[model samples]
Target: MMMKKGFLLKQILWISALIFMFGCGSEEQFEQTASGLEYKFHIKNDSARPVQLYDIVEVRMNYGTHDSVLFASGNQTIPFQIDPIYEGDLLEGIMLMHLGDSATFVIDTEDFFVKMMQSPQIPDYADGEDKLYFDLKVVNIITETPAVKARRLEATERKLAEEKTIADYVEENNITVAPTESGLYFIPITEGNGSKVKNGDAVKVHYTGSLLDGTVYYSSFDRGMPITFVAGSGEMLAGWEEAILMMKPGGKARWIVPSSLAYGSYEREGVKAYSPLIFDVELIEIVD
Candidate 1:
């Protein structure tokens, strides 16, 4: 009986050692950081600078569990600005990485779901597991500055001409369409087909923009080139985005953009503050 007990103990220890050495092979390389995070460096660039606070970062990211993928930024080259949700979370892990570094950070499923995601409970699909692996490759990090955030030059005197000028133009042009709930007037000249425009869609458009006083500021027609901007990406003015969202491919519309929807209270290039804008816009293509 003593010899049998000794043999069992030896077998248990041997198996434990084998699992520790070879179970996942790379398990030894992972280092614990924070309370519930673990990370391993597959590629590290010692010369590159680490990410800083409020810096906009472009990352090729795919976060998932052992068996399933939850979300992926597929072929989207758009950058994500990092703001830490907690003291020791995924954003902090990202801050630890340098440019061109490839690493994998393991996050707790409970922390991800309950804490960060604000879900009621861990989902049934991740029932037995408590870790979500984020395979990240730090692409580019842009330092945050006021110039990049708000490009305001100087506060200009308010003219308050937007409302009256837009009203006058609409009356003169025989435009008769009720304004939308957000105080935007979109008059369609041609109908389009397919899905309604939403965020993350690359849309190509041809536009001619002018002040209500008939001063043309910018036009794609004169340049002989169409401009493309992502929908809901803040690449264009609010009035432009709102009107384009109501359009589809091969559609054309006239948008009367008040200063509130255009550049409000700040003088911009070739346009005065509080000025109403008129745009003849055509949606040339919608790249999915």
Candidate 2:
């Protein structure tokens, strides 16, 4: 009987060992940095060249809580210059990876939360026990020279000034408008009479887009043809899509689009980098 009891105990111990080796021990696959950041390589390309400080790198990233994806840059990669002076685990992990490498970074929730406190999109239910995970792929690396760096810095400064101008205009005008969660502000000029515009609907609109100082950049009237496009098709700026969806046929409204929702830091045609745009738009019709 004692022998049988001993045999049963050994069997239990063996099963527990197997479970630990195959399941809970999976965390051991990840390597820890000196700062306690953990990362595991999903794909490693040892032959690919690595990047140095100040090198511009294009990376595709998906970031979220362990259980849910909050944001993802699908297909479109983001370009950023590596700044060794910047302090963050994400940057630290990225610096360790080479082009063509894909890795998952695990960051402490408390640290991530503190860093992300300024962003309103963070869910209220987030807790310190939870971890933030980032899946990153280094796509491309570009060497930055002194002239290129100077140009980039000038553009960045211009963008910051433009944003400040927009904020000052908003305050001085005492503009009372409905602000979207994404920083767009809409002031209804005239309510529409028909159904509200929705995603997948074909809509025609006449618009006059201008800078915050009321400098007209583009006008559909000047082209003599109203612009027509599928709503929410991503064919237009993010601010335009958000505002159009709220309007009905025959609606007229003024929209204040922040630069982040507009051309970002890119200068396109008449729009400059970080320009907050003002649009006076009339939703003429909604077809389909």
Candidate 3:
């Protein structure tokens, strides 16, 4: 009986040892440290296109340090500004680091803005939130660095400067409008009894606009109706807002818009930089 009891105890010890080993091996270990940041990646395509260097990516990241237990949480879909450090060409950073390798790089927001401005790429503010960091790793890659982050900043700055010059040229050349403090000029054609335009009025008016060189930029005659906009709101440019105020339902007039009141210094597809603009506008109807 003594030998039998000793054998049963040995069998129980062996079973427990096996169970312990199995538990440890099953636990998943990450090659990248959470470090307090999480990148929630969504694949739009299972066999997705290769990630480019300058291509804007939509990533969901928890922008905080790993050491903090309580973190600020929010969702962001912003463009990733790829610089030259990645050598202007690479298939994907993750493929270079391997499928599971991860790393973090802390970037300064103010400095980022200054750098972007230096290139003159005036980025439009989607909502005006400032400063962000990017944490990335290669998931898959078929190529290595060689693609260049194109220089669009200088072109953007040139466009903005040109628009401003256009506005200034109109003003300096005796373009003739009764100016207001809000950077608008009004020239009235018809004297009507009704209010110029109401807050909720569905106003319509035909309009034709041209550059200083007699190049017609836009014309409502082609569109088949007058342009409509809400008054006292940002629906129209500064010049348009001021011009409409001087019109009645059937009034016709002209407006010389400065670059400040138009597209600023930014160049449009066909519109060159710093070109002054002219508009011969007509108010046809106001549907209240």
**TM-scores for all candidates?**
0.45, 0.53, 0.43
- Per-residue lDDT for 5 in model 1? 18
Poorest stretch of ten by lDDT in candidate 2: 12-21
Best by lDDT: 2
How many residue pairs clash (N, CA or C atoms closer than 3 angstroms) in each of the candidate models, in the order given?
A: 0, 0, 27
Off by over 4 Å in 1: 1-158
The residue-by-residue lDDT of candidate 2 on 182-242, one tens digit each, is: 8898999999897899888999889998988889988887887788877755456667768
Q: How accurate is candidate 3 locally (lDDT)?
A: 0.43
In candidate 3, stretches whose alpha carbon ends up further than 4 angstroms from where it belongs are 1-178, 191-193, 273-275
Error of 3 at 50 (Å): 18
User: What would the C-alpha RMSD of candidate 2 be, to one decimal place?
Assistant: 15.4
lDDT of 1 at 162: 49
- Give a tens-digit lDDT track for model 3, residues 236-273: 55466556766777777767666556544334544553
In the range 1-288, model 1's lDDT, one tens digit per residue, is: 101112211211110100111124365678877554678776799899888876877776666665566545554434554656565677778888899887777778777654444333455556667777767777778886786444322222334444666777789988889988767889899988887678768988888888877898889878888888777654456677678889989999888877667655434467765677788998998985
Top-down lDDT ranking: 2, 1, 3
What C-alpha lDDT, on a 0 to 100 scale, does residue 120 get in candidate 3? 16
Residue 90's lDDT in candidate 1? 76
Kindly provide the TM-score of model 1 when superposed on the true structure, using C-alpha atoms. Answer: 0.45
